[model samples]
Structure formats: structure tokens, C-alpha cells
Target chain A: MSIMRLLLVEDNARLASLIREGLDRQGFAVDWCESVAGAEHALKINAYDLMLLDLGLPDGEGLDLVRKLRRAKLMLPILILTARGGLDDRVLGLDAGADDYLIKPFQIPELAARCRALLRRPGASLGTTLIVGNISLDTAERTVMVGGHTIEATPREVSLLERLLRRAGHVVAKPALEGALYSMDAEVTPNALEACMSRLRKRLNAAAADVQIRTVHGVGYALFAPVSTDG
Target chain B: MDKAGNRKTGPTGPTLFRQIALRLSGFTLLFAAMDVAIVVVTYSSQPESLAQELLSLEAERVQSATDTDPDYLAGPPGADRWSARYIDDLGEIAGASVGSANGGRLMDWTRRERIAGGYRITGVRSVVRHGKQHWLLMQFEGDGIRPYAPVILDEIVQHVAVPLIPLSTLLLIFNIVAVRRVLKPLRQAEAEVDALDPDNGFHRLSEVTEPREVNTLVRAVNRALMRLDEAMAMLRSFTANAAHELRTPLSIMQLSLDRLPPGEVRDELQADTQHMTRLVEQMLDLAQADALAPELLEQVDLADIGREVVAAMAPKAFADHRDLQFACHGNTIVLGHAEAITRIYRNLIDNALKHAPGQTAIDVIAGPGPQLSVRDHGAGIADEDLPRLFDRFWRKDRRKTDGAGLGLGIVQKLAQVHGGTAMVENAADGGAVFRVTFLAAEPAKPA
Candidate 1:
């Protein structure tokens, strides 16, 4: 499999290097730029899977770049890394066509999970029913079964499993799952997303599913299907 | 002279309208009194002049009668030259002299001449007597003092007194209307100033109409407002710049800390970073809340916000072995922005969880005014601490809690933005209740 590539536009040298190191450890080839001008040059030359942008750039604002790329009709997924407060930058960046936003001082694992979630949206040709070892999920039927026996699940659980099954091997950020489960207008309870994931993990385990939900501490969750040993 | 003095000494003691009315009434009364005094003085001195005029007319009549009657003035019948006599202008003696024989010893009084002592000169000319012109002259000498004050008073009452009442009444009515017109702008300015909210410090006094007096006052007030607006803007910008600069480095520190390996040392560092992050975030929130304009608010459902916050904090409550529940009495609609109201609820719940000990249950109650109160079953707030609970960076036990002491301050500010207030008190059942009340919006119409 080809290595997944990411472009990071950040001005802060220490923060940019740390994030690059962290994503590189997660098996991503990240190209870093310090300004919007440099980012534009990199984008013109390279075909990247996704772009992680910083809003406060030395040469120009990250939002301006997002707008420029979107205006050019580029379909690349862009996630904003902003130090701005929630009231302003978050709303404006999303309105400007950013796929997601992570506030600064965020965990490295969380950023990795978000990148994985963004990458999973494309190139998944597994059809409506996802099979990860013995665990099978039918998106159309909104049902989950292990070894051909159905396990009872709430609607919320069914939707969560569908999201997890799509990115079966990759970790999904808590906020990404939260966004999937609730509409923008819905008020999500604190730790509500974690509680839902916990319940789903218990249900999948009780049903003797082959896959297990593994939690990435200070990050999110991932569905791991153990390698088969019965050769 | 001192109306626009220092604010404490200004005419705020009474309503502007009343002050203007009193001044107008005072001027009117002074003018009216002067008018009355002028009339009385002029009328009072008229009696003496009237007596002199009568004496002059008698002298003129006597001179004209003597000229007409050549024999009567020579010595009428048995009259001597020194005897008091009356002569008609037709050369005939008309009647006995009104003076006593002793009057002859007095000085002769002539027409237009002054009578020295106790005597009065009297004369009458026949304006049309018996179809013949006749003038009579006589002199009286016993007691010249006769009461003419009554006659003068009768003249004054007949002419001047009749119109004085209605004229003064009209003057008074005109004074009142004129005073009100002159003070109309001042009244309006007063009302406008009363309604001016320091929260929206940019507003200025409206322009006053012509008549340079009112314009001067209005201009001064507007100038003061402009200065106040500039000062407030400077302060606000300073706060905004300081907050932004401070948050940048804090964000970098937090991001760097996130890259460390998971361990006790890392955990401790992360906790400190979280504490710093919260302080920065709260400072921003507090500033934003303080700067929020009242007109920008909208209808918000406190119950809905409360329920969501309780649900969101449910996991934390569970982690701490506590129960968090929400109860609503009725429709809790308040006039405020939903985001701000939501933050208020989040802060209250967080404050409760931090302060309440022993895994106590936190109950959130929502009621009318769309009021929301968070009750925590912990040691109640100290009596001395209640007043300062909403003060910025004030904590009862700063070392015991992880809060930056800005959460309640933000809550208080948000409540004020909504045209409401925030209060905290110890509950009777050994806990503390933090309540926020907002202005009630219009009732929702039925679908």
C-alpha cells in the first residue's frame, strides 16, 4: 500500500516540528510549510491526501488559503488548526469550507485520529456491509451481527458502529464520532460520546465479535481485528 | 449658577421639570409684584395733586367771575373788602361764602396758587347752568383735611382693578406654557441620559433645538459622552489585546505538553496546562460577556440549555460518584443568546462539581423568568464570602480548588448582558444554590 501523505501549513517552528514528528510516527509522510505562500507552492507540486492548516500564518491567514483552494474547486479535505477562540474562528473556518477544526494545544493522537477519519471518507470500496473478521455490519439494515447472529443495538449504537466499521483499522477522533452521531444543533452531553462507545464495546464483546474496540488514551477509539492464527 | 456643577452638587435633587417650573414661577411672581407696586405708588401720590388741582380751578373761577361782575366784586350789598365772598361769572353773587369771618384773616388763595395753612380753595363753573354761563368761587378755612383716599381708591378700583385679575391670570398661564416649552429639551435630555447604559457607552445625547442656552448644555453633555466613549474603547481594546497575546504562548505551551509521554510527570504537567488554558479561556469569555450588547440578545430556553449541560456533565458526575439531574417547572424562555446562556449553565455545573464534596448530588432547577439554579449538596458558602462570590479572581479557598475564579464572574457578567442578575446563597439543607434570572421574553405563540 502507498504511504498516506499530509500537508501541514504552520508558522510556529516548535509546534510544527512536534506535530510532524507525531504524524510521521503514525505512518504518515507529512510535508511542512511555514507560510501560506509556501503552502500554495507545495500544493501545486504535490498530490496530498489531506491538508492540516494553521489559521495564524506569518505570510497570510489560513482561512484565506482555505478560501483560495476551495475557490479553485480543489476537493482536498482541509482541517484547520486554530488557536482562535471557539466563538469566532471555528464558525468562520467551517463556513469557509474547512472539513474540520482542532483547537491548538490539542493532543497528537487526537490530530492523528482526525487525519485518519478524513482519509477514510474516500477510497473505501467495501460496499454497504462491512466485514471485519467475524463482526459484520449492514449500513442499510442498521444492524450488527457476529457469526450470523444479530445483536440488539440502539439506533445511536448502530450509527456509531457504522462510523467505526468504515474506518475499521484507523482510529476515529472522539469529536468526529460525536459529529456523526448528533446534528450540529444537538446539544451533546459531556463524555456522552465516550459512554456510547463504551456501551458499543461491551455489546460487541458480549456477542463474541472477532473485532475489539481499542481506545487510544488521550485520543479516541479504533476497531482492531486480530490477525488470523488458524492457518 | 451651579446647575452643571460636579454631579453630586448638580440639580439632580429634584426633577428637571420641577426645577424649571419653580424658576419660571419665581420670575413671574417678581414681575407681577413690581407691577402692583408701581400702580399703588402712582395712585397713592395722586390725592395730593388732586387737592392742588381743585384749588387752582377755584382760583380760575373766582378770577373769571370778578372780571364779568364789575359791581359784585366792588362790595356786594353789606360785604366789606376783607369779607369772604362768592362771585358768579355772570356778575352776580350766588351764595354765602363757605369760609368763616375768621378766614378773612388768612392769606388770600388764588387760582394755581398754594394754600399755606389749614384751608382749602373750592370753585365751580357752570358748564351749562340754566342756559347761561356762570362760574362760582368760594374759599373754606376751618379744617382743610378731608378724606380723599376713599375717592382715589374708588377711582383705582373702577379702572385698574377690574382688568388686573384676568390679566394676571393670563400672564400666569403664558408663563407656565413658555416655561414648559423652554424646558422640553432638558426634560428629553434627562430621560435620554437616564436610559443610557454604560454597557453601551458609545451613545451620545441627542441634539437639542435652537435657543443657544439649551444647545450649550446639550453640547457639553455630548462632549462628556464622547470622552467617556473614548476611555471605554481604549480600555476594551487593551483588554482584548492583552488577552490575545497571553493566550498565544499558553496555547504553545499546552501543545508542547501534549507531545510528552504518558506518566505521572506528564500528567502533572498536563493538569497545570489545563489550569492555565482554562484561565485564559475564562478571561476571554468574561471580556466577551462584558462587552455583549443587550440589543444583540435573542430568546433562549434555559431549560433546554440546562438539560444539555447536565447530560454533558453526567459522565464527569459518574466518574466522581455523583448524581446530576435536571428538573423543569415550566417553560423557561429568557431573552439572551443561546451560546452565552449555554456557557453560563456549563460554568455553574462545573463550579458545583468542583466545590461540592463527598460525591453529592447536583440538581439543576429551571423555572419562570426562565431562571436556572444549580444546587450542590456540599458545605455551604461562608456568609462573608457570598458578597464576593462573583468578583473576579475571588475564591474562598483558592488553594483548594483548581478554578481561576473567573467562572462565576463570567456568569455574573452574562446575566447582566441578558438584563438580569446572578445570585448565590446557602440552602437550608446544607448546600449552596447558584441562581441566574433573566428578563422574560414574550410568550411563545401556539403552533
Candidate 2:
């Protein structure tokens, strides 16, 4: 698989380097730009898989860059990485055509997870295989493998498992899971999504998968690799 | 208290209209008094001369009577009671000359002297009647009535004082209308001042439509407001800069920490960083609560905001092993800042999650009215600590809680900015309930 390349536009050198180091460990190649001018120049020279744009830059506003790229019909997914935590700023950034927003002081793991989630969307450049720990699900083949062995699963279980795998290690809210598992007009009972989640959990566990499905009671579910006992 | 101070203390003080009316009445009264004084002085000083003129007038009347009819003067006295006598010379009268001569002729030769009970005015005129030169004497006796003083006073009362009553009343009415008309612009400016929202620095009292005096005052107030706006803008920008400057380095530290291997020390450092982040965010929220402008407010559904906030915080509550539930009833439309309203619910739920024990339910209820309340199943707040719950930076057992105690204070401030109230009370069912009520707005009709 080809490496995922990201263009990061941030003014603070220390923060930019730290983000680069974090993303590099997550198997992403990051190109850092310290100003809007540098970012624009880099965008012209490099075809990036995604862009992490900061709102405040030395040369210009990052919102202006997002608008310019969108006006030029660039479909690359852009995630706003900034310290502007105001709700108005968040709405303004999203309305200016950025794909997502992450406030500063965020965990690097969370940032990488958000990037992966954005890339795994339909028509995105990411591959069809979703992996967390030893469990892997292939969207193109509609199959699940645990430790190189196939696991027979129902279509509904596969759908739930795919949604969980997409946002692995993060709590996926119950409404989001329901939206993924049911049609809009489907009259779903309150326990219907929980029932599906329970089935998926049982199937993955029965296949001796290295992942665990944890229920944050009354909130949602999360998938995480089991803590190694050897540690 | 002194009379003036006492009047000022209550509603008994004279209004601007009444004060102007009274002043006008006082001026009219002074003019009336001057009218009376002029009448008295003229009547008292000129009586003697007036009497001499009357005597001369009688003599002339007799002369004209004789010209018309030779026997007219020889006839008896007329109704005016002037006794006429013929004398060879005027030296018989026992009185001094009281009239002046003009052109070497005694044009008015008259005298006045005190009689037994009154004064007499007598005049002598030499004339030829039937070709005989003789002196004609005419005398007038007046009893000591002295009715001029009372007459003058009565006339003044009838003409000057009586007329002045209605005159001053009309003046008073005119004055009231004039005062109101002159103050119309000031009243408008007063309304503008009352309507000015302190959070909205753009509001200014109008200077164009006011009178010159009021315009000066309004211009001064507008200048002060301009200065206030500058200060507020500086404060807001400072807050933004502080957020950026503080959060950037914190983010770097968090990123570096995430790279450390899993251990107790790493976990403890992560916790400390998380606490610092929360503190910074709360401080920023406190600053923003003061900056919610009137333009940012709108008709939003408290139920909608309540549901969204509950759903968003449910994960945190669940991770802490506490159940979070939301309930809504009826229309909960309110005039509010939507994001601020969301923060209110978030803070209340966060507080409940922290205070309530694990395995307990935290219920968030949004109204039958424009109110949202959160009830947590835990030991209720102590009676003594309830009063300070909403105070900024005040905490109960500060060491026990991880928060900086700014959550409730922000809730209260945001509620107040929306023209609402936030209240806390210990519930009877063994928990504390926090309720925030907002100004209700009319629901929109279906299109």
C-alpha cells in the first residue's frame, strides 16, 4: 500500500514538529508548512492525501486557504487543527468547506483516529481494508479475518463491525451506530442496535479475535485491542 | 430629616412641570402687586390738584351757563351742589391761592381750606354781565369720606388680581406644554440609555435629533461608550490571544506525553495536563460569558439544546459509571444565545457527574416551560453551601473536586445575559437539582 501523505500548515515550529512526529508513528508522511504562503506553495508542488490546516498563520487566514482550494474544486479532505475553540469559530471553519475540526490540546491518538475516519469514507483514497489489532475487515470483499482465519458473520453484524472498526479505540455514539445499521424510515426498537452490537461482539469473540468490544453503558460502544498480559 | 431632603426621599418632590408652573404664577402675582401699588400712589399724591381742577371746571360751567342764558347763574344750585355768589372783589375768601397763573392772567384762581367737618374748594372769576364788571365766586364743600384708598384697592382686585387668576392659569398650562415639548428629545435619549445593553458596546445615544444642550450630554455619553467599546474589544482580543498562546504549548506537551510508554508516571502526567486544559477552557468560558452580545441571541428551543448536550455528555457520564438520561415535554422555545445555552446544560451535567456517585442516574429534564433542570442521585448539597454554589471560584471541599468551580458561575452569567435565572435547590428525593429558566419566546407557526 502507498503511504498516506499529509500537508500540515501550522505557525508554531515546536507544535508542528510534535504533530509530525506523532503522525509519522501512525504511518503517515507529513509535509509541514509554517505559513499560508509556504502551504500554498507546497500544495502546488505536492499531491497530498489530506491537509491539516491551522486557522491562524503568518501570511493569511487558513479559512481563506480552505475557500480558495474549495473554489478551485480540490476535493482533498481538509481537517481544521487550531486552538480556536469557540463554537462560532468551529461553525465558521466547517461552513468555509473544511471536512472536520479538532481543537488544540488534543491527544495525538485521537487526531490520528479522526484522520483515519475521514479517509475511510466512501470515495476517499484509503484502501478497503479496516484493521485494528489482529482483526481485519475488507469492505470490497465483505469479509472478516482474525489471525489469518475467516469468520462467518451475518450482513448486519458485518455492518456494525465495520462502523466500530472505522472508529476503533473511540466511543461511537449509539445514534451514529443506529444510523449506520438501519435505513432512515426503518422503525427501530430501542434495543435493536444493542442487540446487533451484542451479536457482533459474540461473533468476534467466538472467532478468538484480539479485539474487545467495550460498552460505555447508556452512551455507546468502543473497540480496542486487549491489553497484552506480557507487558 | 430636613424638609428639602425629606421631599427628595420619596415621591412627594415637585416635578419639573409643577416647578415651572409655580414660577410663572409667582411672576404674574408680582405684576399684579405692582398694578395695585401704582393705583394707590397716583390717587394719594394728586388729590389736591385734582380738587383745584374740579373747582375751576365748575367756574367754567357757570360762565358757559351765563352765556347761554343770562339768568342761568342767578338760578338755584344744580345737582352737583356748587354754590355760586357775586362779589365785587375776590379778597373776601379766607383761603390762599392754590392754582398757578398763566400769561399774567389768573386762568385757575382757586383755593382750598379746611372747614368745620370737611374741606372746601372755592374759585373766583371776574366777568362782565349786562356790561357790569363783577367777580363770580364758586365754592364746593366735600365731606371727609376718603373713599379713594378702598376704591383703588377694590378696582385693583376686580381688574388686576381677578384677571390675573385666569392669566396665570393659562400661563401655567402653556408652561407645562412648553416644558414637555422642550424635553421630548431628552425623554427619547433616556429611553435609548435604558435600552442600551452593556454587553453590546456598539449602542450609542443619538446626538443628531437632540437639542443643543441635550446634544452635548449625548455626545459626551457617546464618547464614553466609544471608550468602553475600545476597552471591551481589547479585553476580547486579549482573551483570544491568551487562549491561543496557552493552548498551543499545552497541545505540544500533550502530544509529547502521548509518545511516552504506558506507565503510572505517564498516566499521572496526562492527568495533570488534562486538568490544566480544563482549567484554561473554563477560564476562557468565563471570559466569553461576559462577551455574549445581544445580536447573538435568538429564539432557540431549550429542549433541543438540552437533548444535544445530554447526548454529548452521556459518554463521559457513562465512562464514569453514571447513567445520564434526558426528558423533554412541550414547547421550550426561549430567547437565548444557543451556544451559551448549550454550555449551561453541559456544565450542569458535568457538575452532576462529578458529584453523584457511580451507578446513579443523572436526569436532565427540559421543560413544560422554558427551563432546563438537572437532578443527580447523590447526597444533596449542604444547606449552608447552597448559597455560594453559583459564586465564582467557590467550591465545597475544594480538594475533593477536580473542577475550578467556574462551571456554575458561567451558567449563572450566561443565564443572566439571556434575561434568565439559574437556581439551585436540594431536592427532597435525596439529591440536588440545578434549574435554569430562560426568557420564553413565541413558537414559530408552520409555513
Candidate 3:
């Protein structure tokens, strides 16, 4: 797959460089701009997959830039990174047409995970092949593989695996997983989703996948790749 | 200053209506007394004039009686005390002196003299009765011929005191109405002052329509409020700028630490950075809660906020090996600032997570009074620690210093800002329940 391109609009030079380096390690090609004008000029010339914006820009507010891009009919997903951690600020950022908001002083891995979550939306630019650790699901082919070996799984388990693989490192809420697994009008039993999740967990375990499914009781489930002990 | 002085004198001090009413009643009494004095003086000094008036009235009756019947001898019906006699000449009464004649009357003269027991006033008039010239004489006698003090008092009571009752009542009614009319603007100004919220800098007592004296005070108060508003605004902006300045560097440090190789040193630094981040976030939250204004409040669903907070904090609770659960009963709508309400729930849950033992579930419940409560199955707070739990920078144990102790303070302040309250108590079985209640609001109707 081609490397996904990202535009990083941030004023702080060191922070911007560090973020770019971190995103580069996550297999993203990041183009950095220090001001709204520079960002606008870059957007005019580049076909980027997504934009990472900082609210406090030198020339203009990042919210205004998002609004301008949305008004101009640019459909690329924009994630706001801001030092303003107030709840009102987050609401305002999303209300002004940004897809997601992340408060500052955040971990790079979390940031990358959020970016991937945004890209994994139905119409987003992310490819059909979803990979988390040794497990990968090819959406176009409707198949699941562990360590390059195909696994026998029901269509329901495959769909559940795909949903989990899309948000691999983050907790996908129970209601959200249920919504993704069933049609809106379907009459689902109380334990149907839980039963499916258990079956899928067993299947992954039997196949010796490197990934692990962790259930956060009363909250949701998260998939994590076990840490490699070897250097 | 005057208002403060008035307040210092206590609530029983005179009001404007009382002061005006007292002065009016005083003037009414004074005028009533003066009227009585005048009546008494005039009645005492003019006794002779009164007697002369009675004697003349008697003389007319005698003349009319002689004309009707020449042998009439009985005194006029009600004037038996007056004596009447027919004489051919005025020389009959010795020591009789000629008195003043009545103006515009023929053969009418009055004479007054001291008798044995009293003074006598005699009025004589010449009348041609039965075609013969005869003089008709009438005399009135009384001790000193002066009105008694009690009689004068009776007259004054009848004429002055009786009428003055309704007159003074009318005057009092007029006084109350007039005073209320004059103080109406002041009462309205008082209401405006009462409605003024200290956190809302834009609210001011109206200066227009107030009386001149009260307008001066209102203007002074408005000026003070304006200055206060400016100072508060400066303080809030300073806090906001401080937050920005502090968090930017913290973000940089966190990112830098995130880029480091996986090791114990990096993990320790990351934990320290996380602690600092929590501290900064709590401090900023406290500042924001402090600056929350009444105008920013709106109808918000406590259930929605509770669910969101619990969902967001569940992962953290999971990391600590605790389960976070949320349950909402009926409609949990309340008048509040949405963001502030969210913070309140987050803070309570955070506190519960920190205090509750590992592997226990923390339950967040919203409902009933539109109240949000967080309960954890851990050893309850000590009795002595409950009172100081919400105080800023007051922690139960100083040795276990993971928090800066500002979270509960922020929670309490935000709750109060939304016209709500925060309280903590030990549950009957075990664990501590921290509850915050907001003023309930009616649910919105569908369009």
C-alpha cells in the first residue's frame, strides 16, 4: 500500500518536528507547516489523506482554518491538537468542522492510534487491508489471516475481527461493537454480541495469533499486540 | 455608607413610611390642640357678649307676647330663668346704667350690672302695645355670666375632636400612598441589587428612575462593580494565558518522553509527567469553575454527562484493575453548565478510582434529584476526614501523594456555580459515596 500523506499544521518547531518523526515511524509521510498561510499554500498544491492541526497558529486560529477548509468543500479528515483541555474547547473544535480533538501533553502512540481511528471511517482513505500485530483482515476478500496463514472462521466472527482490527489498540465501546455487528432493525438477544466475542476470542487463541483481546469489564474491549521480548 | 449604617442599627429601625407617618400624626395632634385652645379662649373672654345676646332674644319674645295678649305673664317657654316685666319708666331699677343700643333697631338698649349673687344683663325696648306707650324689660342672671371649662371642652370635642378623627385618618392614608409612590423606584432598585450575581460582571443596578439620593448610591455601586468586573476579567485572562503557557511546554516534554526508548527510566519520567499534567489540569479546572457565570448555565442532562464521563474514565479504571459502571434512572435534566457538570462527574469518578481498592467496581448513578453520585467498594473515609474532604489542597493522607488535592475542590466549586451542592458520606454497608445535586429542570418538549 502507498504511504498515507498527512499535513501537520503547528507553530512550535520542536514539537512539530517530534510529531513528524513520530508519525514517520508510524509509516505516515508528514508535511509540516508553521502558519495558516503556509498550510493553505500546502493544501492547494498537495493531495493529502488527512490534516493534523494545532489550534494556536501564528497567523490565524486553527478552528478558522478548519472552517475555511470545510466551507471550501475539502472532505479530508482534520484532527485538532490543542493545549486547551477544557470540555468547551473540545466541543467548539468539533462543532467548527474538525473530525476529532486531542488535548495536548498526549502520548505519541495514542495520537497515532487516534489518527488511524479517524482514517478507518467508512469513506476515509485507509486501505481495505486492516493489520494489528500478526492478525490481518482483508475486507475486499472477506478473509482473516494470522502470521500469513488463513484461519477458518464464521462470517460473523470475521466481521467482529474486522471491527476489532480497525481500532486495535483502543477500547471500542460495547454498544459501538454491537452497532457494528448487527443491522439496525435486527432483534438481538442480550448476550448475542458477548457470545460472538467469546467465540472469536477462542478462534484467535486456537490459531496462535500474536494479538490479545482484553475485556474492560462494564466498559468495552481492546486488542493489543503482545510486547516482543527480543531486541 | 448610609445603607450600611442603617443595617447596623438593626431591622427594627425606622423605615421611611414610619418616619413620615409619625411626623404627620404629630402635626395633626398639635393643630388639634391649638384648635381647642382657641375655642376655650374666645368662649371665656366674651361672656358679657353672650349674655347680651340672650337678653335681646328674651326681649323680643316679651314684646311678641304683649302684642298677642296684653295680660300674658308667663316667661318665654324655655327661658324661665330670665325675668320679664312691663314698666312705664326706666327709673324703677336703681343703679341701672344706660348700655349700648343695638344698631339699626328702634328703642332697644342693653344694661349690665352686678347683682347680689351674680351679674345681670337687662335689655329694654319701648313698644306701643294696645295703643299705649310701654317699656318691655328682660334680664338674664347667672353666676359670673361665663361659660364653665367643661362646657367649653364639650364644644371643642364636638366641633374639633370628632371631625378630626376621619380627617387624620385621611391624612394618614394619604401619607402612606405618597410615601409608597415616592419609594417605588428605590424598591425596584433594591430588587435589581438583589438579583445582581457577583460572578456575572455585566449585571448592574439600574441608575435611571431612582430618586436623586438613591441614584447617587446606585451609581457608586455600579462603579465599584465595573472595577470589580475589570479585575476579575484580568484575573481570568491571566489564568487562561498561564494555562496555555504551562501546557505547551508540558506537551513538548510528554512528546519527548514518548520518543524515548522503552525502559524503566522512561516509564518513570512518563509517570511524573502524567502527574504534572493532572495537577495542571485540576488547577485550570478550579480557575474555570471559579469564573463560571450564571449566564453560561443552561439545561443539561446529568445522565448524558455521567455516561460520557464513565465511558471516558473506564479505560483508566481498567488499568487500575477496577471496573467503572454507570446507571441512570428516569430523566436527569438540570440547569447547569454542561462542561462544568461533566467536570464534576469526572472529578468524582477520578477520586473514587484513586480511593477504591483494586478489582472493585465503581458505580456512577444519575437520577432522582438530578443528582450524580459515585460509589466504590473500598474502606470508607475516616470520620475526621469527611469534613475537610472538599477543602482545597486537603488530602486524607499526606504520605500517599499521587494527587495535588485540587480535584474535589474543583468539583465542589463547579457544583456550587451551577446552584448545586456536593456531599460525601459513608454508605451503610461499606465504601464512600460522593454525590452532587443540581437544580432540576423541566424536560424540553418535542417540536
**How do the candidates score on chain B by TM-score?**
0.66, 0.67, 0.66
lDDT of each residue in A46-71, candidate 1, tens digit only: 99989999888888889989999999
DockQ of prediction 3: 0.42
| DockQ of predictions, in order shown | 0.16, 0.37, 0.42
**Candidate 1, CAPRI quality class derived from DockQ:** incorrect
Query: In model 2, what is the error at residue A46, expressed in angstroms?
Result: 2.9
> Which window of 10 residues has the lowest lDDT sum in candidate 3 chain B?
B98-107
Q: Higher-TM-score candidate among 2 and 3? A: 2
Better of 1 and 2 by TM-score: 2
Give per-residue lDDT, candidate 2, residue A136: 91
- lDDT values of the candidates? 0.72, 0.78, 0.79
Which stretch of 10 consecutive residues in model 2 chain B shows the poorest summed lDDT?
B98-107
Off by over 4 Å in 2: A125-152, A169-194, A201-231, B1-14, B49-112, B115-149, B158-160, B206-211, B256-273, B289-312, B327-341, B365-371, B383-388, B397-401, B413-421, B436-447
Instruction: Encode model 2's per-residue lDDT on A157-186: one tens digit a residue.
Output: 787888888876566677788987675347
lDDT by residue (B330-427, candidate 2, tens digit) is: 66898887778889999999899888776788888888788989999899898899889999999888785488999999999898888889999988
